[model samples]
Target: MSRIGKHPVPVPQGVQVQLAGQTLTAKGPKGELKLTIVEDLDVTLADGKITVKPRQVTRRARSMWGMQRTLVNNLVKGVKDGYSEELEINGVGLRAAMQGKNLQLNMGFSHEVIYPIPAGIEIKVEKPTSIKISGADKQLVGKVAADIRSVKPPEPYKGKGIKYASETILRKEGKKK
Candidate 1:
């Protein structure tokens, strides 16, 4: 038995969880999130808890068991408290700002980069070099943050560009004369 698959997800107060067909939906104060269960796994909701079990004792079924359980867990957590990612901009003139619903990034590029915010996602520029991305969907929030970070990935030489708030850049030695 998979460790994570056997663990039951507990539904918190003010949160509702429902299973219709293969789709699981969670509604809460933050927002609503839904996830489709993959084949070879069974998901059941009972008494304010969700449990996952493999349909068969096979390699594929075992592999997907833990993954499916985690997906369900994420849905519950997302609807309950939501998710957020923060990015830090480095460099002399590098900065981030919100222009309407889009994000304007000045990362030493010849032209400013404009990143359009997706639905259900919020982007806030708290400071000139700090950016916060929040959303109910964990995957979507992470993807958006990765896309933004890819725009100006930190370089090893100068260690300048966009990086996660908790990320550490390895500084490279400069060339000797």
Candidate 2:
């Protein structure tokens, strides 16, 4: 039995959820999102809650039960409250800025790195070293943040690069004398 799958996801007030065939759609103040449920599991909505269960007694079905339920939960929460990811630029002279609808990054490269902002996703550079990415889709928001960080991932030695705001770099010892 999947522990997470056993708990139904509650649809909060002001949020509307609909299930059609294998697709689940949620609409709320933030935005509207849709998810295609896996065939190995059964999903249902009742009394303002969404539940997931395995269709058969099998390893794959059991494994997908909890994950599918979490995905449904994410859709509900995403439409209601949205999601955001923060990044921190560490190192001297490394910074970020917004130019029109694009993100400009300065990470010791010869040419400035220009990243075009995607539709439905907002990127804000509160400070030159701090960035905040927000969107109604949790996956998109996280992917955008990861792409930004991948441009100049933090190094272990000097920790001079871009990283998540809540992430801690494991510094390595410098060259011995």
Candidate 3:
């Protein structure tokens, strides 16, 4: 049995959740999101709560039950409050800025790297070293952040590169002469 799947997801006020066949749609003040549930699970919405259950007593159904439930929950929360991730740039001469609508990054590269902002996603640069990525779709927000971070992932030696604000890099001892 999946612990998370057993719990019902409560729908908050100002949010609407709908289920049609294997598809689920959630609309809220922030935005709207849709997801196609796996066939092994069944989802129903009633009394402002969404419940997910396995369609059969098989291993496959049980395996997908909890994951499907979480997907639905994420859709609801994403439409209602959205998701965000923060990135921090480290190293000398490493910084970020907005060039019109695109993100301009200077991470010790000979050429400045420019990333075009995607639709429905917002990027805000507070300080040159800090960046905030937000969007209603949790997956997209996280993907964009990962794309940006991949440009110059933090090196273990000096911890110099782009990294998540909450991430901690382990330091390795350098060569002993």
Candidate 4:
């Protein structure tokens, strides 16, 4: 059996959780999220607690079971408190600004790099080098962050690029001949 999958997910107050057929829905103050459960997985809901079980105790089944449980847990947490990621630009003429719901980035490009923020996600650009992205869905927040980082990943040479607030970019010595 899966250790994490066997545990119970405690539901907080002011939140509603429902398990219908192959779908699991969670509603909270932030927003609502619905997930379709896969086969061979059993989900139990009652009295503010959710539990996950697998049809078989095989290794693969156990892995899936834990992942499913984590997904459900994220859904519940996201709809309640939500999630966010912050990115900082480090380079000359590299800055971010908000154009309505889209991000305008001038990362050494001749033209601005326009990026549209997806639904359920919010992007904010402060004065110079900070960009804040928030959402009620974890996956969406991560995707948006990844897209932004891809524009200009931190280089080991000068560490001049965009990177997560919590990320560390190691620097390499300049070539001297």
- CA RMSD of each candidate after superposition: 0.9, 1.1, 1.2, 1.2
For candidate 1, which ten residues in a row score worst on lDDT?
Answer: 39-48
Which residue pairs in candidate 3 have backbone atoms (N, alpha carbon, C) closer than 3 angstroms, thus clashing? none
How far is 20's C-alpha from truth in model 2 (Å)?
A: 0.7
Model 4 per-residue lDDT at 66? 86
TM-score of each: 0.97, 0.95, 0.95, 0.95
lDDT of 4 by residue, 52-167 (tens): 88877677777789899999999999998999999999998899888887889999978899998888998888767999888889999999999999999999998888999999
lDDT of 2 at 111: 95
Task: Report, for every candidate in turn, its global Cα lDDT versus the true structure.
Answer: 0.91, 0.93, 0.93, 0.89
Give candidate 1 misplaced runs (Cα > 4 Å): none
Error of 2 at 53 (Å): 1.4
lDDT of 3: 0.93
In terms of TM-score, how similar is model 1 to the real structure? 0.97
Model 4, runs deviating above 4 Å: none
Task: Name model 3 segments beyond 4 Å from true.
Answer: none
Residue range 1-177, candidate 2, lDDT tens digits: 999999999999999999998999999998888999988988889999998988898999999998899889898898889999999999999999999999999999999999999887989899999999998898899999999999999999999999999999999999998
Tens digits of lDDT, candidate 3, 25-113: 89998888889988888888888999999989999999888888888888888888999999999999999999999999998889999
Residue pairs in collision within model 4: none
